[model samples]
Structures are given as structure tokens and as C-alpha cells.
Target: MTVDIENLIDGESKFVSFSEKISLPDAYSVNGDVLVKLSGKISNEKKGLFHFSGNIVAVLNLNCDLCLKPFNFKLDFPVNELFSRSIHKKDDCLSFSGNIINLEPVILDNILVNMPMKAVCSNNCKGLCEICGHNLNESDCRCEKEHINPKFEKLKALFEESENE
Candidate 1:
């Protein structure tokens, strides 16, 4: 995604919009191409400084962390950044050389930063059963419900004795 600033005059702002599917090969968790929609304004602040302020709407295909099921995740966030023609050693603004400013890097950075640490299909999702590796969301597992570690055997005997008395 690139925005043309050749016609933008100093102190003038132009509205920019883009709707496209972008491939995110760096995003390991993303299952497919991301649908990105960007709407924002790019303003020429000075001779070489420009400011871009806008909103992004993206749809990502991801797998649920719990059940490993595929799902669509929607992300909406605001972006405000600076672009400069000259590079500064300690500057945070992105540097651009030509009249066109590439927004792909900015969009990718924002999407990655805003991504959730854990992706869950739903709050009530039932994960796979540990013993049989069955999908608990689809059906119940026949594995024993109560399981105690060997280290807790003494504790279990104590509880049994107390119950008998």
C-alpha cells in the first residue's frame, strides 16, 4: 500500500484510502492473507515532514489457541505516525525518499502490535482431551474423569480413612 504525495502542497492535507488483501508471511500465527482497509489523512506539516492519521480495519484468519480451530479475527485501531524525507539518527518517524510513501510496513507493524496474545474461538470453548486427544467441544471423552498423580496416593488414602470414620 502506497500513498502519493506529489500533488500535496505544504500545509495541505489529503484524504487517503485503501482496501486490499495483503500477505503477512512474517506473521506465523496467521493462516491466510489479511484483508486490510485503511482510511486516513496525510498532511504536509512542513518541507519534509508529513503526518498520517487514520484508522485501520483488518480481518485475519487465525487458529484458536485452545481448540486449534480456524476463525476470523477482526481488528480495528487508530494510527498516527510521522514521515520524513531526511533521516535522523534518533528520530522515531519513518523515513521516505520519493513522493510516494509506502504504508505497508506501517500497517504491518500496527497489526502485529495490536494482535492478541491468545486467540480464543469463544469463552466456553472445550479444548481437546489430554488422554485421548479428542475434541471435547464436539463430544464427551470416555476417559476416566478422576485422575490422581502417584505422588498424591498417600493423601488419597488419608482422605479415604477419614471418610470411613
Candidate 2:
């Protein structure tokens, strides 16, 4: 998305808002289309410097890490960016060539930075059964429950002896 600032004058601010469905490139394990809603105001602070402050809201489709189920995650955050029309790009501000400022890069960066490391459908998700590879949240599996690692067998016997005493 690009913002037009050709008619904006110095010391003047414009209120811009838009709701668009954007297809983000597959990134950070996020796939499919996203609904992005941006509402902000852009102000020309000086001759070639602009300041934009507003909020960004987006809905992302993600899969649960534990259950492997697809779900929607909503992200809402504040954004404050500086734009400059200088020939020499500075490390602190974003540089633009013409009277338009590209917002896609900023939006993508914020979304990726705020993405969760682990996604879960719910807090009490049971995940999948280890032996039968069945979704334990739906129903219990018929696999044997007494299977224990040989390394932990001695520990289990010690606990049993202590309980008897």
C-alpha cells in the first residue's frame, strides 16, 4: 500500500485510513491472505520530513503448534514511523523517492516482529496421542498406557517403596 503526499503541505497533516485484504508472502510460518486495517495520520514536520503515527490491525491464519489445527490470530499494535525525502538515506528514517510512501514494508515488518513463537488453539489442548497418533482432544486412544522407559523404571520402584513405608 502506498500513501500519496503530493498535495500535503509543510506543517499540514492528513488523516488516512484503509481496510484492504493483502496477500502476504509466506513468512514466519504464516500462510494465506490477511485482512489488514490501518488508521493513522501523516504529518509533514518540516520540508522533507514526515511523521506517521497510528494503529495497525491484522488477522492472521496460523496452525496450532501442538494440535496442528488451523486458527485465526488477531494482531493490534501501534505504529510510529518517520519518512524522509532526502537523497542520502539515513539509518533512522525511511527514505522515499517521490511523493508516495510505501507502507507494505513497514506493515510486514511489524507483523513478523509481533508474531507468536508458539501458536496453540487453546490453553487446555490435549494435542495428539503418542502411540496411536490420534487427536486426544477428540477422544481417548486405546493404546497401552503402561508403557514406560526403561531408564525411569528404577525411579518408579523407588517411589513405590517410599509410599509403602
Candidate 3:
């Protein structure tokens, strides 16, 4: 949505509404899907300021770090932003250009900020089997469970010899 600064020049207050399907770049493109639903309410108080608050909903196709399996995850978050034409901007204020204020960047910024630190399919995800490269969440593996890999056997022996010395 674009807000016209001229509308508030006549001492008139206005509210602009927006609801649309927007697309984000492939920065997070594991499955090449980054479309989202963006909806918001922007209001001008006629005091040379605009307040924008909204929510973003998107289904993220992410790979589970442990299992390495692709899964569909729902991501939703709220956005609170302030836009103004004043030269004296607040700490979190964004400045607009000319007589128009574009909202595309604002919405994308909020979505990036609200992204999860980690993506996991479940709390107790069994992850992948190391020996057979199988997804443990789906099936069980007969491979013996060892904390240390056999490749590090020499390092373990050296450390054990040092302990005896």
C-alpha cells in the first residue's frame, strides 16, 4: 500500500488498509517458496506522522537441521512500525520519500526480524541415522549407537596414554 502525504495536508485524518499476497526474495529459498500474506492498517494522525501495524503469515518450507528432511512450517508474526517525514527521526522511525510512502520494505523488514532462530519438525525429532543416512523419525536403524566415531580412535588412545603418564 502507498500512502499519499497530500491527504493529510488539509488537516484531514485518514486510515489506509491493505491485504495482499506478497513475495519475499529467495534468501531463505530452501524449497524456492517465499510467498506470504501481508495485511495491515496504516493511519495518519494529521500531525505529520504515520503509524503502521500489521501481521504476516507464511508457510515456510524448511529443512530440519537434525533430520535433514523438508517440512512445511507455519510462520506468523506481528509488525509495529512508525513512519514520518520529520528530519528529527526517532530511534526506530523510518523516513519516507517525496509525497509517497511505500510499504513493501516495511513489511519485509518485520518478517525478517520475526523469523525463528531454529527450525525443527518436532521436539523429540530422532534425526538421521549416521551409519545408513536414514531418517530416524520415520524408521529405526540397527547400527550401534556410539558417542565417538571410529575415525577418532587414534586421538582417544593418545589422550588415554597421556593420562597414565
**lDDT values for all models:** 0.88, 0.86, 0.73
Taking the tens digit of each residue's C-alpha lDDT, what string does model 2 give over 54-132?
A: 9999988888888788778888999999999988787989999888998888888888888888898889999888778
The 10-residue segment with the lowest total lDDT in model 3: 7-16
- Candidate 3 lDDT at 3 equals 69
Q: Mind giving the per-residue lDDT tens digits that candidate 1 earns over 1-165?
A: 898999899999999999998888646346557779999999999968999999999988778888888878889999999999875622878999889999999998998899989998888989888888888999998897667687788898999999999
| Pairs in clash, predicted candidate 3 | none
- Candidate 3 per-residue lDDT, tens place, 1-165, comes to 576766565334455556555666665536554667666666674545777777777777777888988777777888777787777876777888577888778867776776678878889999888888888988898887777677688888999999999
Clashing pairs in 1: none
Model 3 spans with C-alpha error above 4 angstroms: 1-23, 147-165
TM-score for candidate 2, please give it.
0.83
Where does the lowest 10-residue lDDT sum fall in candidate 2? 24-33
lDDT for 108 (candidate 2): 85
